[model samples]
Target chain A: MRLLIEIEVRFGEFVLSVNESLTLDGVTALFGPSGSGKTTLLRCIAGLEPRAEGRIEADDQAWLDSKAGVSLPAHHRMAGMVFQQALLFPHLSVRKNLLYGWRRRGQRPGPDFSEVLDALRLAPLLEQRENELSGGEMQRVALGRVLLSAPRMLLLDEPLAAQDERRKAEILPYLKRTIREFQLPVVYVSHAVDEVMPMASRVLHMDSGRLQSSAAARVSGGTAFGAILLGATLQRQLDSRLAVFCVGNAEVIAFLDSDTPNAREVLLAVEPRDLVIATGKTDAPLNAGAMDCTVRSIGEDETSGNLVLELAAGSSSFRLEHSFARHSDTVLRVGQKIRVLLTQPARVASPIVQSGTGRDSA
Target chain B: MIRAVEVIELDSLWLTLRLASLSTAILMVLATPLAYWLATTKAGIKPIVEAVTALPLILPPTVLGFYLLILFSPSSAFGSLWVQVTGQTLSFSFTGILLASVVHSFPFAVQPMQTAFENNGRRPAEVAQSLGASPFDAFITVTVPMARRGFLTAAVLGFAHSVGEFGVILLVGGNIPGRTRVISIDIYTHVETLDYASAHFLSMLTLCFAMLVLSLVFIVNRRYPIRT
Candidate 1:
């Protein structure tokens, strides 16, 4: 499914103007800091903000077109939205709340109630009142309620922001299951980068109500270490022959691999200091994974007395920063070709396309 | 001491209950929409409309009584208009007394209902709208149910206020026996004829009835405190 939105909205002191189109076969993360217009854009897509200008079309259907003077209301748009708060009705039982939207629509074919209940794990809480449930249980029920509406698109606005770590860990797997099992396209809004990393296939970055950049990043599990580069395919199992991955354009082979079935796209952790740069291909005997790379850009790391180099290989790019040394080997400039070597290799499981969609096996 | 004179005062006591009950019922039906509009409308002239509704609260009873007396009299414009429309004068009639009571106690009925609607925050209504409910449907399903306590308060206050009215009733419907001789007027006639025992008996009954209605107001309001 394709979702297109080009809308400009002005509220008192804040002005938001966004024009972009996103393909939705997988989860797309609207990633940004607070007050970055992520929620506004989501609302506009749902037809909640009628005052916004511009057109929005999803799956080739015209949902909102300002020039044409056509705007569908929120309910008619049929996009299920879950807010930060669970917003369960206090007076209604879990079952009644789940069926609220279904009963209201009169007669429309939608997701089966039992299926949604089973997916969200809400069957046990069906008879309980909203106030009686814990935070995680309430959110699970809220998800069930939205799913029962059987919306064409799902909008989740910081669904995990209110939860504690324990609650988040408990709900994360269930959410992953929903995305994989249902195959529903989702526009997930979040301020936390870590929260979106594992769930999002594509990340749309925003700053001050403008699109800064959009990139297709390989999804990785929660880790404190910097970014990892995964290979396209896992070739073969080597006893000490670690899987190698290219950073930017410079390729490095690592001697680490696990026998896990899903490990195809392996990850290599590179500390900036471990990389050695030369003016030309090195004559010295090198480690298993090392390659000739060209310096594309250079910048200083103020915290650590090191110079960061952006190296290029064909169209790909990666970074290598080295600390100050008494004997500086070479002064690197943009567009300068250089060779780099890795002294030690840390191997990881190769990433595999576990499900129908591509998921990092790391 | 309980006396035969007190036993004879039951008729006026019964008449006061009937008048208060009827007037409260009429006001409830009429004031609900008016109160809802007052609570929700953002029109520029809303304050002006509110002031008009509150006229009876500030206006002296004697002043209101005089104006109502003139309007219902046969010689006035309204009296002539009523005669033309219904072929009867309005003065000293049962319907005329009811009209005077409704006007005098309108603000009491409207204030509680208006306050109730204002406290129900706009979020619930917005949620309802998002869920496919039309404006009318939202008001009926969400707004009305949420403000149930307010309606009860308005009804009880309106009934109590109507029963306590003296001057407007006296001027609009004079003390004609078996026709306009309500409880307050009965007490006045008994005193004028030097029948202190009968007057005292009716006075005590009116006081007790008023206290009872007031307690009912407190009880209902306490049980169902309006949810914000």
Candidate 2:
């Protein structure tokens, strides 16, 4: 589904203006610091913030169009939102809370309540009062409650922020399972980069209520290199050397010190600073591999005048950072003539091997 | 002599209970929204409305009663308007006494409810709305249940205060035995007639009832403490 959002809202002294479009077939994280309007943007998408002005369309359906005066109320939107606090009804039992939305919409049962109960490990707390449950348990129940609503899209605003590490770890697997099984588009708002990096397939970074350039990238795995390695075929040789036997249309060479007889696939990481950019052919005795690459874009880091070069090897693109003085010697611009020389082998590390597949990967 | 005095006291007790119960019921239904509005509204006129609701608390009972009497009299504009609508004069009637009791005891009903709503906070409602509940649904399902203690406090206070209302009832409805005269007015009449025995008995009953209501408020509030 295509999710397009261009909205501006004012809250007291803060004004939030966002213009973004993302495909919602997978999880997208709205990542930002606290009070950076991550939650406000999510609320706008969910139709909870009425003051927002602009157009929002999900799956080509116009959910909000300020000029056309077409704005759906929160209830009418086909989205489920989970808050930081569970905010479960004190008088209602866990079962009732989970079934609240089901009963409200009178929709046919989509996900089995019993299955969800087992997934969230809430079977033991079905009859428990809201106040009696622990914070982690409350969040689990809250997630179940929203899922039972059978929404087309899910909006979560820091669901795990209030929990401890143990609780977060406990519920993350179940959350992953739900996302995989449902395959619904999800917009997760969070300030924790670790959480977003793990769960989001697309990360949209926000700062001071504005979308930052280069903050939107498809996050497939822990590192950009790991994502490339997932689909690449590799050959490991002696002398702690590894070769990317095949990477789509390009080949890469790296060094691996580990010897595992059954190791067919391996993970790799490369620091941009470790890479050297060259405009001419150089034969050096350094223990590094060279690959032919073209410069895609060149930009400078705001804090440090270090040049960040976007380079493409075949269809795969990666980044390399060079110092300001080095970059100044070369005339670098978008579509500039350049070659990236890896002075050292890209460090190869064992794949962390996530428990599940890409389902949980936002 | 004691048996006859007990019977008369019971009659006044019954009148007091009837008036308090009816007035409390009316106030509860009416004040719930008022309290909710006071707790949540950002309307420019909220302060004015709140002040009007709390006016009886600061006004002397006699002064309040005098104004109510004038407001409910047959010759007054308000009274004539009520008569035209209901085909009956408001003053010196059971309905008039009920109106007077509600006005006098409004703050008792509203204050506790307002505090309860305010203490419960707006987070739950916002969360509920995000979870697909409409505003009214959220209020009834999430807010009302959470603020249960406040409702109880308001109900008890409104009932007890209405039972003790004297000046307003006296001025508006007068001592019309079994019709408009409540326990407080009954005690006044008994004392005015030099029946010290009857007056003393009725006053003690009123005191016990008030204490019971007050203790209930304390116990309920303590047991279900609000955590905002």
Question: What is the alpha-carbon lDDT for the whole of candidate 2?
Answer: 0.72
Model 2 residue A195 distance off true place after TM-score fit, in angstroms: 1.5
Docking class of 1: incorrect
Per-residue lDDT tens digits for candidate 1, residues A92-184, read 689987876666665656678888888888888999976689889988887777777667767888898899989998987777777777778
Model 2 over residues A1-362: C-alpha lDDT tens digits? Answer: 77778889997889998887766756775654446787888888887787899999877889999999999877767578888878887768898999887666666446778878777888999998787888888988988888877777888888888888898888778778777777778888764544554455544556568863222222212121112222234654536455543333444456654542234444344444445666555753356655566677666656566665666665445555567425455577677656555565654433323221222221
The candidate maximizing lDDT is 2
Pairs that clash in candidate 2: A199-A362, A200-A362, A201-A362
Give candidate 2 misplaced runs (Cα > 4 Å).
Answer: A212-362, B1-8, B211-228
Ten contiguous residues minimizing lDDT sum, candidate 1 chain A: A219-228
lDDT of 1 by residue, B1-228 (tens): 456544446655666677788889889888889988888787799999999999999999888988998988879988889989999878898778888898898999899899978877554554454555555776787677677778887888898788777888888888876566788888888889998878887788778877887788788778654322
